[model samples]
Target: MADFLNNLRTFVRVVEAGSFTAVANESDCTPGQVSRAVTSLEEELQALVLHRTTRHLSVTDVGTRFYERAKVILADIDSATDEARNATESPVGRIRVHSSPGLAYSEVATALASYQASFPAVSVELKIEQSMPGLVEEGYDLSVVSATQLPDSAYISQALGAAYSVLVSSADYIARHGLPRKLTDLADHALLQLESPVSAADEWHLQSADDTHLWTITRTPFRVNTPDALRAALFAGVGIGTLPTYTVADDLASGALVRVLPQYHLRPFTVFAVYPSRRYLDAKVRTLLEHLRATLSPALANAMEIVETFTGDATAPPASPPKRVAGTARKRPAKRK
Candidate 1:
């Protein structure tokens, strides 16, 4: 019975990941072993579930039906197990979390450490990448994603907090290139662009109290997809680029990186904790979300406060908060430092 359940879980993972090797890596096993688990299940059921070839693997009609049922069965079993264990046991299990490189470095990585310290039995594996991965397909228990608008999906998203980006350049870069005196002068300078979910690649819409300006860069001598890489390039005096204030808060405070046009910043966005099956959230996932809200909420608020401080508007009354579109901020103050 236990072996059958293990096989069922492995089969579900293989179907979602679309690769036996991927499931094997998650399980810390070999591909052949994972393939054998599927074979064993097929033999037990006396039916073919998948079409296999050296270069192609597809679900059969029967496999698709079986996959759906098996997924529900596993989810129910997990829900039941968690419910039974919750009353007496501390949350104990391995949690796989996916996050973008910037947020992982600036926030989630540290939060996970404190979470584990409190729940000593819970172990975590963090995967940092630029793209969002399927929570179930990639075997991630949760994903901490920062974006202006989250792509439509079935996963449940809990807003961790709001965050925003700002234009920044190293002091040395300013010394070498000379700061832009006005928006038009940016055209003559080395404008670094960091590609992120919330930022446009070739242009930026910088917002101030009075109005918004569309500043477009004609040439990007250096363009990067990750925020950290962009930050490094700025440190190297590659060009002036925008960064999440939280990622560069220390740098700005230490005068390592100086904010450009402190009053004008990119639009604000929300950081979300996304996961599968809101109804059956495992105790571990639920507690982790709560911990994040407590820790990251203040951190993000502090980031916004930092922006206000440097912009020399700390004493002014806060502007009207922007209206949310699709449960996310459309345009607001930068929340993450």
Candidate 2:
């Protein structure tokens, strides 16, 4: 019976490929062997599965129904084999992870380093892309994403943390343009804008305890599609820009960029670790998620501090301001009440 079932599987493969030669090539056997297997399978089932001509193979209605059943059966057998192997093995397998390029460089890369160190048996393949790929169709075990909310899908999402974005400029630019003490003051300065996926003119919206404010400031003097490029531009004193705190922690610490509007804050964005249904959850995927959760908690705390240093409090003793240089200072008349 086992031999018969094996031969039936080979017949199913040949039927699916639509040619004995193709199935033979895939199964690493001769076309004659595939023909024999199909013949044997048909004898056992007492039904003709294919109508063969000189040029093509056509499936009968019964063959079509049998093919459908065989496909499901083959899938179940594959799943069973995988589950059984996982029960004994140390969860060793290749895990493919997809993430946004900016987050991949900033946070995901660090998290993966620790994860790989801890799980020596598992291998990770990370791809940074802007488009959301289908997890199952693409055969990715996991993905990390930052978005306003969880996407509606069958995939399971675990919240890693919240990302806070803030408007920032180089200390030199702020010194040259004068600080924007209020939302209205933003119009007077060169505002570096991030182009959205949907449109070019989307404005940065900010909120505070008392009220919400929208600024239609000028677009970035030089626009780039990526967050890393925007960060570089801000560092180079291109213009004031908005970005996630995690992407600019080191720069903020070094005073390369200073946060604007310390009084009002922008809305927070959510980060999620998403994966397909847990049925085929590989060991690498589980370990990666664990590592990320453990590592990102403190990292997120530090990121919040960057925001706090700018928008929350500056009670610490002030450091000496930079020396005035060309295009580094703005002359403005005193405001009248």
Candidate 3:
């Protein structure tokens, strides 16, 4: 159909030029190809469009009427193509983004605000949930997800950054229950659990260097499904739990929460910006993605470095502003049981 559309275009040009050679030269094709284009169109319509003689060519009554209608069709198609091509330059549309609860709460807000400030013509709708929604089925323009390994799917994934989770507890809780000096001591203290898609509900996988330890949760006084709730539980001096460094950086800095086992951390997972396709990516989505890569990735990297520096040292002074860190640091791979 696309080729046939080109033929229709050639026929229109030939009618206006009154010579196949003229249109052929303009199109940079042979006069034979130009003539074939008209021939194909004539065969499809099963009518003679041009009365040809050795000296000249004239349009029949049927050809005259068809030419007018075909001209309008081609013009409309050209107009539509131009508008679509220019959409990337002036983006104006609503973008619906889906994200996990923890990331949406802690990370996406500032990036979204900054993006809106720059591109005031684009509006965004953010939805947060624990489970992953089908991007196309659910009408999502993009999704920000964190996982150890993404399952096989049709979506395109871009790694924004990677960060490890830190085990932390409130100072008051440590004072009341006594600080856990070793991995086994954690069994004696109340354990608050945050159930997440990438985490197990009944166990915590702790790793340091090449050694890995699995701490089974036999008893738990508090278990929640969201990162904010888990952080709140930790703040209330309920028990110790693990949180992403980005989520607890300020708390650790402010002495609201102290690192528990600084040497060991939960497995690091990547944050990904997922979308349906890379071909002709919308300007609204592309700008948002670029903004996040510039802002959010660096923020996560800085948070990891800041938290790593203060690890195992609970008496450290208030943290200064974190400096930007480039490149990922090497760590032992997580061994999950």
Q: What lDDT does the true structure give each of the candidates? A: 0.79, 0.71, 0.82
- By TM-score rank, best first, the candidates go 3, 2, 1
Off by over 4 Å in 2: 1-84, 87-89, 196-201, 312-337
TM-score of each: 0.68, 0.68, 0.76
- In terms of TM-score, the best-performing candidate is 3
The lowest-lDDT stretch of 10 consecutive residues in candidate 2 is 328-337
How accurate locally is residue 82 in candidate 1, as Cα lDDT from 0 to 100? 71
lDDT of 3: 0.82
lDDT for 157 in candidate 2 is: 88
Compared with the true structure, what per-residue lDDT tens digits does model 1 show for residues 1-337? 9999999999999999998999989999999999999999999999999888998889999999999999999999999887667723457778889989888887778788888898888899999988789889879999998988888888999887887888888777888878766677787788887788777878888888888998888788999999888888888888889888667665665456777777788888999889987775677898888888888666766666655556743122234422112211112222223
Q: For candidate 3, write residues 247-334 as lDDT tens digits.
A: 7776766667789878899888998999988889888888889988988888778778778876656645335735434322212112
Clashing pairs in 3: none
Q: Tell me which of candidates 1 and 3 scores higher on lDDT.
A: 3
